[model samples]
Target: MKDRIALIGLGQMGLPIATRLATAFDVVAFDISAERRELASRHAGIEATDDLIKLDSEAVIVVSLPNPAISRSVLQQLAPHLHEGATVIETSTVLPDDVREWQRMLEPSGVRVIDAAVLSGVAQMEQGKATLLVGGEDAVLADVQPVLEAIGGAGVERFGALGAGMAAKVVNNGVAHAVMVVLVEAFAMARAEGVALTDIAKMLDREDGGLQRPLNHRIMQRMAAGDFDGGMPLEAARKDSTLALAMAQRSGTPLFATQAAQTVYDIASGTGLGRKDYSAIAQLWEGWTDRGLAYGA
Candidate 1:
């Protein structure tokens, strides 16, 4: 069997994954950025291209795009060219409905669509510690499990039928944002009570599990320093939040916390901080209460 795969989108997340996958299989990297394409091409065993038409012969195509619309667009462009029995692994954090749409459009062409919602930062993906929440036909997944496993060090699991992966990813991102907001608010309360962030960190570390203190510690440390330079950008974070809210409305589920968080995110984006790390969300709490949530005074 030919061990070739095409990877679309060479942004922050896609670039590292494509480069890593190149170590185990022939990788064709695609991105709109000439610079990113050039960079990935330098990696051994990886070919970079700006055109999906160049990937027409590959049996497997993995898309790690930014949003639902782009994922659908790329798949649509590639659908006409994908070989029969080809599997398109969508690793974007998009809506489940979007995944279904891809399936409907491509399955008739003899192409199989699967959702592989990747979790963890780009740095983690480079280290092969990322997790993929996968949803698709069982036989299709089994055929592509090896390639998927190569990218997921945190492991991959079949969550449900098509769209389940996206559903899990949306809920996961929404809950994460909601929790971050509440944590930031609680830390603000700690500030009001005259507790230093340094002291709070020590207090938080006292717990072993279930608190997510280690993760919380890193985010709080960055916020204290007003550092939102690099990480999951506020823009990408907002897409997940808004999508979650949309899903809630469609399902008639009350998502009070998520809705509240979205308002805060809206204000953050309005302030021209959308390109900054989602940790910039601290700006909201900082405005409500005067205090640096960082380690020092």
Candidate 2:
């Protein structure tokens, strides 16, 4: 059974995902940014549009927006027009409570809402190697397998019902951000202590699960070489980190590490490094300790 899919949001994360889906299915995709829409059309073969309602009629609708508010707006706009039995897959990071609310809003209209947050980064999408944490009804999930298969690259599986997928993504991003902060802090401290920054980075790269394996390592290498580009912008990272902290607080969960990670990103943002790759969090090192990473570029 061919599944017609519509994807909304064409930002950094969504564009690649939409592109992968378009490779296997006809995707009606839209982005709030006109430039992004045009970019997706050029690169992905998506039928890009500015109209949110136009996407509502597809067999399965996928969303990969920045945060909860934008995702909710898309859901609210599309909810009234979605056909019965249509599946709505949310790949955005959002609060679990909001996911339940969306489920409630769409269920009455006979629309099934599923949370399917993409795990890992955009580079994984090219290899179709990204993992999807899914939450929704079994039968509904079964119905959209082909659509999920085409886009998920690696695969998809249910964690449980309603907001479980989002919970997984929430925790995953929180921990990952924390780890990145730790990596930056340790490297910076080494530099301040008179060890060469590049040498320390080289040492870390040689350790098991080397930094170079992750995309950020490439960015870190660049940063160490004074390149400071490649990974997600520190501004975007700050937004995600902030969202994670907000979600944790709203749920009465303590995320001390997550909170600390937010502060580090905050420092990066404050230091005018928001547009730089998140690896620029190392600037905190250079700023506080006066040690600079020499970049060959």
Candidate 3:
């Protein structure tokens, strides 16, 4: 017989993941919504239930809850009944601290917890193209690798011991969400300036220009090496930012991310980093947090 796996949360992403896992393991699915439970029950390899107690016998449990609070609440309710040596794979997009707390809460009961952040959407899950950013003991992760592969056929990136996966997920999301806002702001300004959106898209799509170069080439290399010297200086970049702001003001365009970025440039320049590379703006973060973010620091 196939190994039994208990799956919690059958929402948008969770439901797809459950169905995918059912292709390999005998999946016991649970959800608070009756409709969702019914939907999961219709799948051939899944056994859907409302009772949390029904999951007690399963050695592997996967959680994909909406938020940390709900995840904690559900885990708290199920903790006492979990069999010894059970491993819980938490795929919720929560903070590293939150998963660490869960690990602490479940450790006394011989329940192992691993944070496996789902890095893709429902469509990716359904297509088996999703990736999992995992953090846990190597042995425990190896034990559950097949289940992870069943859900995330794209790949699994193991970040490190517990909480690292959530950290990676949060950082990845921060960049993606911030870039989205930046794009929106840029598009709004482009529309105001009568520039074709397609033109802007084409410019940004270039392999040697736009987002890729700055992130993958000069700036990132300089920042990573802590060698912020002899490049387009911060002062020059600040001047360019000033020009952009002036143009935006003249065009009656309000900028959010760009305006905020200008503030960082201004502050970094004022602090005598104007002579360094434009990437020196990163130093402000190190100073603010008293942490070395540069590689090998």
Best by lDDT: 3
lDDT by residue (1-22, candidate 1, tens digit) is: 2598889999989988897688
Estimated TM-score per prediction? 0.69, 0.64, 0.96
By lDDT, the better pick of 1 and 2 is 1
Instruction: Please estimate how well model 1 matches the true structure, expressed as its whole-model Cα lDDT.
Output: 0.82
Tens-digit lDDT string for candidate 2 (1-297):
345578888888898888888788877898889999888888645789998888766878888888888888878888889888888888888877878888898988998888888886889976789889888788978888787787787878678988998898888889688787766655544544567988877777773334544444643465667666666788997897777666556555555555676889887788789998787777677768887865532
lDDT of each: 0.82, 0.78, 0.90
Order of the predicted models by lDDT, top scorer first: 3, 1, 2
Model 1 segments more than 4 A misplaced: 198-297
lDDT-better candidate, 2 vs 3: 3
User: What is model 3's C-alpha RMSD?
Assistant: 1.4
Candidate 3 Cα deviation (angstroms), residue 70: 0.7
Worst ten in a row by lDDT for model 3? 211-220
